[model samples]
Target: MLSKHFRWNKSRVELLGMIILSLFKIQNVQIPKIAEGIISDAKQDSVIKRIYRFFKDQLIDAVEVAALVVDILSLDKYLLVIDRTNWEFGKQSIISSDFI
Candidate 1:
């Protein structure tokens, strides 16, 4: 029967949609532009290739938060940061460090 020859397929529009969705997952736009540039020239790369580029294009949180939470999650000792003045500042780094 003709039904035996039927095959499902995703159109180019669908492929582009999926790829675009991957771009939105990054909280910013710059990385998406870079990812788009990397794969722009490909005429017919595999879906796996697109996914590889997509994941490879991720932005990681470089500031390692020395948290009581994450350490406890890992079952490590909870760090205690005590101040003599009982004053607390954010344990986060400034954006200038990200420039390099």
Candidate 2:
């Protein structure tokens, strides 16, 4: 799916590899942690920055990718967990985050 959307070969491979690493590594979801688990290099910070840039660029449609993931997961029974958090800034109320 990513291969069809991501323009760069490096981006496609990195995205797929990181996803696979996340699935295997149950520790933390942070970029540095995930990069350490997958990459053999010592410079995890650089790898993390690269990953940040890849996502910051928004090379593909996030909504489409999310729908595709949900559809694929629906094939088998699974637990879907969502966590919501509310935040306040100054006198204004910021939108709550929806985490899965």
Runs in model 2 deviating more than 4 A are 4-10, 40-42, 74-100
lDDT of 2: 0.64
Per-candidate RMSD, Å? 16.2, 5.2
Q: Give the alpha carbon lDDT tens digit for every residue of 1-100 in model 2.
A: 5454445677556666575667588477777776777654647777777767766875566666666676756656556664465666986667555431
lDDT of 1 by residue, 1-100 (tens): 1112212234433444455555666434454343453344554344456655545664323233234236437655556663434332586444333343
Q: What is the C-alpha lDDT of each candidate?
A: 0.43, 0.64
Q: What's model 1's overall lDDT?
A: 0.43
TM-score of each: 0.21, 0.51
Show the lowest summed lDDT stretch of 10 residues, model 1: 1-10
